[model samples]
Every structure is written in structure tokens, then in C-alpha cells.
Target chain A: MNHQKREDLVKSVLFVFSITASLILLLIIIFLFNEAIRLFQEVSFLDFLFGTKWNPEQGLYGAFPFVFFSIMATLGALIIAIPLGVSCAVFLAEIAPGWARDATRPVIELLAGIPSIIYGLFGLVIIVRFIKVSLELATGETILAGSIILAAMILPIIISISQDSIESVPKSFKLGSLAMGATNWQTLRKIILPTALPGIFAGIILGVGRAMGETMAVVLVLGNSENMPEVVKQLLGKEGSSTVMQLINQVPEILFKPGEALTSAILLEMGPAQVGGLHYSALFALGVILFCITFVLSVASNYILSRSQISVR
Target chain B: MINSKTSDKVMKGVFWFSALLIISILFLILGYVFVEGIRVVNLSFISDMPKNNWREGGIYPAIVGTFYLVAVALLFAVPLGVLTAIYLVEFRKEDNLTSIIRISVDSLNAVPSIVFGLFGLSLFFYYLKDFTGGPTIFSGGLTLGFMILPTVIRTAEVALRTVPLSEKLGSYALGATKLQTISRIVIPSSIPGIITGVILGFGRAAGETAPIIFMVALNPTMPEFPYLFSQCNALTTQIYYLTSEAISIERAFGMAFVLISIILISNYSARLINKYLARNIRR
Candidate 1:
């Protein structure tokens, strides 16, 4: 073949290959929804989403407990990870010596590379035991346990991305702040952080998405009990105490109790649920819900990242 | 000025402590696992099969199974990922199609691993059950392949982007077609980046447990050699089962040690390869 024709042929082949990622994504959505919609036929969409009970054996499939716990765990993780991760990023970006920075990078990378299963095992053996003994709970596998593991799991992602963004802030900004009688901390707090806020926000969103979708570590430490926290039930119940102080006092009890997450719900039940059955379809619906949540988060992250890049440039 | 100075010092101390705490977590995990697991990880453990219903013995089958799964995942992912990346970097312009493709790739990366498992179970295990023989290594590997595809494409694209424009222009000036320029100038210069991407993908596939759990069964006995269409075991799944069952804590730690070692070594080697390649390209 002529060179032009050969080039055309190669281009078309690569084009087909290029579209495969999009194609696979399309297929995944279609397949998940196709199976998930079947569950709606058996159970109303609102009932599936908002109903509280999730006993599959008797045909009750309320997913609210799982959704509530997943959100709580993710929020808990964010609270723990954000402050520590941002401070660590600042240290690496502006304060750490070159050798220290170099040494820390590989450690973080190795930490990130450790599998979720290992994290789960570590949590199961160590964190759960520690929490059990310290908190004097019947079981240590609670929302707090899951959140701690998730915070650790997502810390690397937050630190690396936040560090990059912080480092990318224009050197001129820092110099100008310092020249105007600003202390190093003052400049970092006012100038550098605001400049890198979009990127850091994007990283935190990505971490939230990860923590929400995390399965193995969460499943191992969450105890996989499909029940709403007792505090939430009390608050919503008619005769429960309405005092703010009392509610505040119950927060620790809520966190210490065992719960379920969306990802763990699917993982633990996938095996016993017969294929094409309502149980299986309900799980796929959960998958659909997870897909939508992460999809939005991912799109938002990409949008912020792109916007930040343009602004920086 | 005195008050501000004291506050700054306190803040600096906080940052240092945060950094130190993060690093200490890594060391703590490593130290805990190695101390408990190292005693159980002798040559016999590496080579021998699990005996007495996985309560005692080495994880040879799981080790072999992880290798096969990673190998198959790489086979499916590398070519498609690299080629797709080539098209994105070389052929595509800034347009709606490009943006859509980029969004899809990012979205795919963000999709939960368990969701991928569900998709795999639906498509490969049920729809194509006859072809895949239902929950075999083939299905599991393909599931992992899709799971890691975005990582491969994104990394390869960055690598391809790093090849200087001048080198491609010189190839074109020498009467090379686009295909020839890419093959001769672009790919050769960006090989290290592509290799790095592949290595990263391999580590990811090997370490993933959720995507493979439903598609592959835990084979207590050794799988038939080279049986791609049969149920198989993997290190990640084995660790999951062992720990969850609380059968043998020692064996679980040993397997976790093995899995972590593989991932860390691969990540370290990829970094080294990229460093070497970057220096060479500059020269």
C-alpha cells in the first residue's frame, strides 16, 4: 500500500481503539441500569431508595440505611483526613527540606500502592482491636472504624494532589505577601491556599468519591449490619428527646455502633442472591446509585481541575 | 509582631507534626505486617500448596493465579490503552469528541471497582457465559482489564505528550508519513512512559480484590494448569477470605505481605525506569 493509504488505515484502527473507553463506559451504564430497572418493577423507586428496612429474605429492600451509613462514613473520613492531609501537603510544598520531600514522596506512593484488602486486613487485626479495647464496645467494627481506615486510605491521594497544587502556586504571590510584612503562615493561609483552593477542593471531592465507593476495607471494619444508627432513629422518632445537648452527647454512641455501607451491601449479598432475581437486581440498583454518585463527583473534579489549570496559565 | 511570630511557630509545628504522623502511619503498617508475617513467609510457604482446608500451608496456587490474572489483564489493557492514548495525543484535536472521550475516561476511572464487578457479572458471567464458561479466570481478568484501562490510558497519554514536537517534525521533514513518524520518533522516545503505565496497571490489577471476587471462585485445591476457563484463586481474594473467616491470621498476614511487596516493587521500578528514560531523552 502507498504511505498515505497505510497512514489512513492505521489512523482508523487507532480511532476504533480510542473509542473503546467511551464504549465500555456506555456499556457499563446500560447494563447496570438494564438490570437495576427490573428491581423497580418489583419495588417502587421511592420505596427502594427511602424505605428503612433492607431484609432481603422477606422481600423488604429499603436501601436508606446503607445510603445513610455510606454518607456518614465518608463525612467522618473527610473530617479526619482533610486537616491532616492539607497540613502535610503544606509541609511538603513549602517547608520540608529537599531530602525530606524526596524521602516522603516514595513513602506516600508505597502507602497508596498497598491494596484495599491489605488495608482491610490491617484494620480487622489492629484498628478494630484497638477501638474495641479503648472504646469498650461489644464490637469495634463500627462507622468510626471504617472511617479511620478510609481516612488512611485516602490520605495519600489528598496529600499528593494538594501538594502539587500548593507547589504550583506562583512564586510571585508568596514573595509579594512576604514583602508586605506577612509572616510565612500568614502568606500561606491568605494567599497560597486561596490560590490553590480549587485544586485542593477537587482533590477532596475525589477523596470523597473514593471513600464512598471503597468496599473491602469498609466491609471488614463496618460490621456489615444493615441498620440505621440508634441516634438517628431516636431523633426521627416522635417521643425522642429534643434537647441539643442530649443530641450532641449521643454522637459518639452513633459512631461507635455497627452499620452498613452501599458498597459493602453489594459485596456481602452478591454471592447469595440468585442471578436475575429481585435480590440480584436490588444490588445492581445499588450499583447504579453508586455509579451516579461517583460520576457526578468525577465530573466535578475534572471541571475544577480544568478551570484551575486555565486560571493558573 | 510578637503575637504573630508565636502563632506562626505554632502553625509550623502543627504542619511538621502532620507530616510526621502521615509518614509514621506507613512505617507502622509495614512494621506490623513484616514483624508478624515474616516468620511465616519461608521458601516452603512460597512454593507449597495450602493444606488442611487452608488452615496450614503456603499459597502457591494463589501466587500463580495472581500472575496469570495480571498477565491476562495486561494483555487486554496495554494495547488498547496505548493505542487509544496515541490517537488522543497524535491525531485528535481540541473538539467535542475529544472532550467527551476524556470525560468518559475520567468517569471510567472514578467508577467503583464493585460496580465493575457487577457489570462483569452481568456481561461476561451471564450474557457471555457460554463463551467465558461462567466465572472463570477469563471473566475475572477481563473485569480487571477494564478496571485498570483508564490508568493505562491516562499514563500513556502523559508519556506520549512528553515526546518533543521537534523530533516528530524532523521525522516528517524526512518524508515520513504520520504512521512512520509515530512509529519511528514518537513511540521510541515515549517507551519508558508507556512501560511505566503498564507496570502501574499491573500492580493495580494484581492488588484489586472486589472486581475479581464474584467472577472467580476460591479454589481450595490447585487449579488445572493453564486453565483459563476454570475457576481460580488469587492472592487478594485469598487474603480477604482468610482474614474474614479468621481461619489463620498468620497466613493472611503472609499473603498481605506478598501482595504489598509486589505492588511496592512495581511502583518503585516504574519510577526508576521513568527517571532513567527522562535523563536519556534530555541527553
Candidate 2:
């Protein structure tokens, strides 16, 4: 074949290969929905989503507790992560010296690469035990433990992305702020951070998505309770104010420990749920929920970033 | 927040604390795992097979299993990912479709590994079991391959895109075909970057625990001992089983130690390779 014809053929083949990404995504969504939708045949969607109990053995498929805990754990992690992650980003981008930045950057990369299993181990041995003792809780496996571990796990992502945003803020903004006799910190707070807010928001949204999707690390630490939130009872006692208080005061030790968080519930159930059974389909439904959440958040993050980029124009 | 008399000091303290917290967390995990697992990491610990549900003996099968799965995954991911990247940065270069493909790939990268696990189960195990014969090396490796495909494509694309347009133009000026120019000029120059991507992907695949769990379902025996059609074990899954079911935290730590070091070493080398290539380019 002539060179031009050969090139065209190769280009076509590569183009076909390139589209494989979108194809795989479509396959994933289809597969998740295909299996997940079957659960509604066995259990009502409303009961599966909003009911307070979830025992596949008894055929009760209320996943409300798991869903609630997943969001709660993610929000808890975000609370710890946002301030710390964003501050670290600011320090790295705006304040840290070259040597300091160089030293910490690898640590952050290494931090990101550590497996969730290892993080689970860490949470199991350290954080869980620590919380159990220091917080004087019935079990250290509270949602707080999961949140702490996840916060640490998601830190590198939040810091890296936010740092990119902070760094991308034009240097002229700093100069402009300093020219008005503003201090360096003042310039950062008033000028650089504001300029980078949208990007920073995008990073946090991504981090939240990450916190939601995290499985193993969270599974190990989250008390894996699949019970309704006892918000009022946990609050009134105020001994630990955390889910620990709920376990301690609200729910009787008589009640079985809260069943399992969403991911853990699916994971724990997966082993026993007979293949092609209603239980299996129910587990797949949870997987579908997990997929939808992270997928939506990822798409939302991209949308925010694209909108921010265009809005600047 | 930065306006008070003590605000400067407070900000400095917080900044230092943040930096210290990040560094300390890294050290804490590294130090604790090494301290706990160092005693168990003798040669036999790595090379010997597990006995009695991993309560006793080494994790040789798991060590080998990790290599097998990662190797198989790379076997599938590297070629397709690199070719797809080539299409993006070289063949198609720039267009609306290219951008859309790029965005899709990025989102795919962010999908939780657990989601991939679910897809792998439904697609590979339940649906394609006839071809895969159920949860063997083919199924597990293919699953992990697709899991890391985005990473490979992304890194390789970035590398290919970095190849100067001048070089491709020069090749064209000499009457070289696009394929020839790419093979001779573009791929060769971007090989370092592609290797870096593979290395990074290696780290990710090494540490990933969720995606391959159900696909392979942890096995006690070594994989690829004779063939890729058998079920296999991995360090991550082994650690999970050992710690949870086997109730052997020490052994789990030992396995985790190996796993963490492998991931960290690959991650460091990937970063180091990038720096070296950059310095060489400058020179």
C-alpha cells in the first residue's frame, strides 16, 4: 500500500481503539443497571432505597441505612479534609520554599499510592483502637473512624488538585494585592484564593466523590451499621456526640451492632448472597448506587471545571 | 482570617501543621508496617507457600500471584492504551471527538475500583464465563487491565503530545509516511514517557484490592505456575483474607509491607524517570 493509504488505515484503526474508552464506560453503566434493576422485581425500589432495615436473609432489602451512612461518612471526611487539604495546597503553592515543596511533593505522591487495604490495616490497628480508647466508645469502628481514614486517603487528591488551582492563579494577582500594602497572607486570602475558588471547588468536589467511592478502607473502619440514624438520642447524651454516642446511648447493646455501611454491606453480603439469587441482585443494586454516585460527582466536577474555565472568559 | 494581630503566626502554625500532618501520616504508616512486619519478611516468608489458611508459613503463592495478575494486566493494557493514546495526540491530534474521548477516559479513571469489580463480575464471570471459563487468570487479568487502561492512556497521551511538532513535520518533509514517522520519531522519543505511565500503572494495579477480588476470588495456590487458566491469589486480597478471616494480623502486615514497598518503589521510579527524561530533554 502507498504511504498515504497506509497512514489512513492506521489512523482508522487507532481511532477505533480510542473509542474503546467510551465503549467500556457504556458497557459498565449498562451492566450495572442490568443487574441492579432486577432487585426491584424482588423488592420495591422505595423499600430498597428508603426503608430502615436490610437483611437479605429475611428478604428485607431496606438499604436506607447504608446509603445514609455512606453520605454521612463522606461528609465527615470532607469536614476534616477540606480545611486541611486546602490549607496544605495553599502552603505548597503560595508559601512553601522550593526545598520544602520538593520534599513534601514525593510524600504526597507516596501517600496517594498507598493501597486502601493498607489504609484499612492502619485504621483497624491505629485509628479504630485509638478512638476506642481515647473516645471511650463502645466500638472504635464508628463512622468517625471510617471518616478519619478516608480523610487521610483522599488528602493527596484534594491537595494536589487544589494546589494546581492555586498555582494556576496568575502571579499578577499577587503583585496587584501586594502593591496595595497587603501582607502576603492577606494577598493570598483576598486575591489568590478567591481567584482560584472555582478550581478549588472542583477539587473538593472530586475529593468528595473519592471519599464516597472508597470501599476497603472505609469497610474496615465504618462500624458497618445498617440501622436508622439515631440523631437525637446521640446528641442529648453528648458523651461522644459521634455515632459512638448513638451506639452507647441511643441503641441498646441489646440491638445487634448496626449491620454494615453500604459498601461493606454489599461486600459482606457478596460472599453469602447466592449467585443469581435475589440477594445477589440486591448486592448488584448497591453497586449500581455506588457507581451512580461517583459517576455523577465526577461528571459534576468536570462540568464545574469547564464552566469555570469558560466563565473566566 | 488573616487580618488579626496574631493571624500571621496562626497561619504559619496551621501551614506547618498541615505539612507535618501529611508527612507524619506517611511516616506513621510506613514506620508501623515496617516495624510490625520486618520480623516476618525473611526469604522463606516471601518464597514459601502458605499453609493452614495462612495462619502459618509464607505467602509465596500470593507474591507470585501478584506478579502474574499485574503482568497479564499490563500485557493487555499497555498496547491498547498506547495505541489509543497515539490516536489521540498524533493521528486524530485535535478535534471535538478527541476531547470527548479524553474526558471520558478521565472520568473512567476516577470510577471507583469497586465499580470495576462489579462490572468485571457481571461481564467476565457471569456473561463471558464460557470463554474465560470462570475467574481464572484471563478473567482477573482482563478486569484489572480495563481498570488501569485509563491511566495508561492518559500517561501515554501526555507523553505522545509532548513530542515536538517540529520533529513530525521534519519527518514529513523527508517524505516519510505518518506511520513511519511515528514509529521512527514519535514512539521512540516518547518511549520514556510511555514507560513511566506503565510503571505508574503498575503501582496502581499492584495496590488495587477491590477490582480483582471477586473476579479471581482469592485462592491458596500460586497462579501461572503452569497456566493462566487457574484461580490466583494477590498480596492485597491475601492481606484482606489473612487479617479478616484467617485472623492473622502479623502475616497481613508482612504481606502489606511487601505490597506497600512494591507500590512505593514503582511510584518513586515513575516520578524519577519523569525527572530524568526531563533533564535529558533539557540537555
Listing candidates in order, what is each one's chain A TM-score? Answer: 0.96, 0.89
lDDT of 2 by residue, B165-201 (tens): 8989999999987788999989988988999999988
Per-residue accuracy of model 1 over B1-283 as CA lDDT, tens digit each: 5698999999999998998898899999888888888988988888888898677878888988898888889999999999999999998888998899999999999999999999999999999998999888889999999999999999999999988889889888988889888987899889999999999999999999999988766756455745888777899999988888788888999988888878878888998998898789666
Local distance difference test scores for all models: 0.90, 0.82
> Deviation in angstroms for A126 in model 2?
0.5
Q: Taking the candidates in order, what DockQ does each have?
A: 0.85, 0.70
**TM-score of each prediction:** 0.97, 0.93
Q: Ten-residue segment with the worst summed lDDT in candidate 2 chain B?
A: B217-226
TM-score of chain B of each: 0.95, 0.91
What proportion of the true contacts does each candidate reproduce? Answer: 0.87, 0.68
Q: After superposition, how far is residue A145 of candidate 2 from its true place, in Å?
A: 0.4
Off by over 4 Å in 2: A232-259, A310-313, B1-5, B217-219, B224-226, B272-283
> Could you say which candidate leads in TM-score?
1
